[model samples]
Target chain A: MKNLLIFGVGLIGGSIALKVKKDAIFDRVIGVSRHNGRSLDDFVKKGMLDEIAVNVEEAISTANFIIIATPVAQTKNILKKIYPYLNADCLVTDVGSTKSEVMLDAAESLGDKFDQFIGSHPIAGSEKHGPDAADEKLFEGKNIIITPHSQANKVQLDCLWGFWECMGGIVSSMTPSQHDEIFSTVSHLPHLLAFALVNLINKKNSKDQLLEFAASGFRDFSRIAASSPEVWRDISLANKKAIISDLTLYKKEIDVLVEFIDNSQEGNLNDYLSKASSTRSEWAEDKK
Target chain B: MKNLLIFGVGLIGGSIALKVKKDAIFDRVIGVSRHNGRSLDDFVKKGMLDEIAVNVEEAISTANFIIIATPVAQTKNILKKIYPYLNADCLVTDVGSTKSEVMLDAAESLGDKFDQFIGSHPIAGSEKHGPDAADEKLFEGKNIIITPHSQANKVQLDCLWGFWECMGGIVSSMTPSQHDEIFSTVSHLPHLLAFALVNLINKKNSKDQLLEFAASGFRDFSRIAASSPEVWRDISLANKKAIISDLTLYKKEIDVLVEFIDNSQEGNLNDYLSKASSTRSEWAEDKK
Candidate 1:
């Protein structure tokens, strides 16, 4: 009977545990809560977790698999705390937005044991948070990118892939640097722009009336801005270099557009808008 | 029997025709298509329009209510064309995104008959265009702002309000300058940003990969970029002064945010994001 231990279970972690346990994928499941430990009590009350562990070290010896499901910022600290106690052959992985820093930190801190760590990020989330927000089918039909560590054992990497596959995720692999670079614009920059636009509108002289009449467009454009500030703060900082590059690039585009609008250059503005319009219409997206 | 002649019928005018015909708000409905004369035939075939008109002069003499549903850039020309034929008692209004320029042109060109024209913008729209996209209930529970001419008769303004109200629209009033300023930031700026961001992403080093991975966030964030290029081109150009001012203000906001992200200033980023997050949560919006 294999044991699966989940650390800092929130939306991502709790959902994984729920899905795995509901499917009876593992014999024993344990969760160590970092969010006030209140969620662990709820999990126990709800009969989801087989048990709860306060000290990760006490739980490490018995677990064959450890999933760190915390924010990316805490990845290094958590890995450091458990490395001395983790079972030699334990399959360790994480579900964080950024991968390069976490993988680098693991390589530096875990020494020869770096093979045990695999960096994975499931591109499925909503603005909601907390354990209660966890859904058993959260990862169903979603893309999960695993940033494989080169020194990691091949069999352990396969096992991690299988775990995500078993939980209904479509598994793919990419280097940590590639993952960060790709997501920097596709996800992080969009969130930053949304946040910035919302704040700009908020601070405007006509904010009260502006917000009052802000309809579906403003609502949809700024929806991601409603996300947890602390989480985004961590993400922007963790993935700073790539995100800054994206922001810088986007800044240039916006400046050029501003000139077109300012100069009332109709032809240039039309061509600029036509590019975006045609591109958006062509892009494959699941309809809202 | 009141005849409502709608020049430049597409989504906005066609929708008004459909709703008013459905409710029997007017005795006659006529649509002149800017996209094509074919849509007018379709509207008549669908029993939304009582007849189609090719010449605004031929239509204007008979219309008790004349709605200029053309693009903002065409407002001055349309006003010049129809003012010569309009009945003194007729209430002429427009459905354009920008109002100040249209109203100013109305005052300048309509000469002593400026009071016959009212600048109104229904705060309801969709990305879809043309007669096929028309919805009878589009104006239901939506706002329509009338930037009334100061020299306009109170009775004529009330008639204008009643006309929109008859189409199931709630009517309000504002100065043309006030309407332009508010919408420049809320409506025009968002569309500009969406377009610019989409183009920026399109021109990126990883356009294909970025788009393939673009999910719900990108979909919602870039939605307005899918708006009609010609329509937006006209709007941004027509309201150049106000939109440019807003673009500049938003540029400043983006610069400040870039500074934080570049410096990895987590504390300031958190607070800035927190303000937006909290504000969005408080605002009434459709759930993501």
Candidate 2:
């Protein structure tokens, strides 16, 4: 009988279990919770998981597939624990936001067994977290990126692609560095900016007053600021190099804008705004 | 019969016409279009306007009220054209985004008749513009800020308040400078940041590649970047002082975050993210 073991079954992990269970992808789905199995009780009750894992070694030894769904920071420790018991045929992957660090951690922790592990990032989530927030359709039509290192097992990599596809994700592959760089520009940088904007407002002496009139524009622009701090903190630290580089480039852009505004350079300002406005409108149109 | 003349009858003016016509608030609603009556013809056919004015001076001389619902840059020009025709009892106001500049334009163009003009900002809009986007309920339950200069007519100010309230707005008062300052932080600065971020991505050689992976977070954070360039350009210039000040402050916040990430200061980074996350979460909660 096939066994699928999920470590740290929160939103990402719980949702995967829900999808896998609904499709009967495995004979048994087991969850090894980071929260001492307390959160896994609901998953079992809902039939999303067959059982909560009491013995990590036993679960890893029997598993055909293992998914590390914890915050990126805990990935190394999870990989270390599972390495000793992982069967040769068992394939391991993670749903981490940043790929490079996870790839490095998997390499260090798994050693000779590193070829069994792959790095995957399903670009789907919400500000909400935990098992309660999990949905079977969380990944439907979403982008699931896999960053497979050169040493990864070919059969395992193909299986990982098939797993994400079966769960309705449009799976794509990229180099680990490429994934980090692209996400740093598209996701990480925007999140940091949102966080910074919110904190900027908080620093105001009239913070409550400023917030009172924040309106829809402010609401939408700052929505990501409400994301899980612990999760983002992990992402920020794990992807520090790319994020810092992007942030520095972003600061240069801000500087140009400030100069335009300070000098009342109307023509330059108009050109800058027009470029952004048109590009964003085109992107939004294509999305629709 | 009370006559209401609305110059530059686009989204804001067209919506006002719709509400006024629906409620029979005026005997006649005359539109003086910025697009030379082409847009107003449809409004007239739809019964949102009583007629399209051929002679601007005649319309202004006979009207009990005038709403200069044009772009901020056009406010001074519109004020200049109507000054010679405005009567003593005629109350004038505008639906401009920036209040201080509009207030200054009114003072400059209308001379002694400036007291007849109140600077108003209806804190309501969408990215969509033009007459087709007008909604009678656009101002329903929205904040209508009227920035009355200290030398303004009290009776006219009260009448202006009544007019907006009748149009389904919750009216409030503030000085023009205060209005500009608050909106500069809450609205203007966020807009510039969104614009800058989008432009930053566009500058990258891998722009389309990067944009391909911009998920919901980037979508929401950059949504305001899709706003009208012409409108935002005027706003950036009109409230340049306050927006520049806020942008400078925002840069400092970015610097602190960068330092934490660069130094691998996990605690500081976590603390920074935690503050933003909690503040945004609380604000979102309050919104609900």
Which candidate wins on TM-score? 2
TM-score of each model, paired residue for residue: 0.95, 0.98
**Candidate 1's TM-score:** 0.95
Which residue pairs come into collision in candidate 2? none
Q: Candidate 1: misplaced stretches above 4 Å? A: A285-288, B54-56, B285-288
Number of colliding residue pairs in each model = 1, 0
Docking class of 1: high
Clashing residue pairs in candidate 1 are A115-A152
Per-prediction DockQ comes to 0.80, 0.89
lDDT of 2 by residue, A134-248 (tens): 9999999999999999987788889999999988999999999999999999999999999999999988898988898889999999999998888888888888999999999
**Could you give the TM-score of chain B for each candidate, in order?**
0.94, 0.97
Tens-digit lDDT track of model 1 for B150-242: 798899988888888887888889999999998888888899989988988888777887786777788888888888899889888888888
lDDT by residue (tens digit), candidate 2, B149-176: 9888889999999999999999989999
Worst 10 residues of 1 chain A by lDDT: A279-288
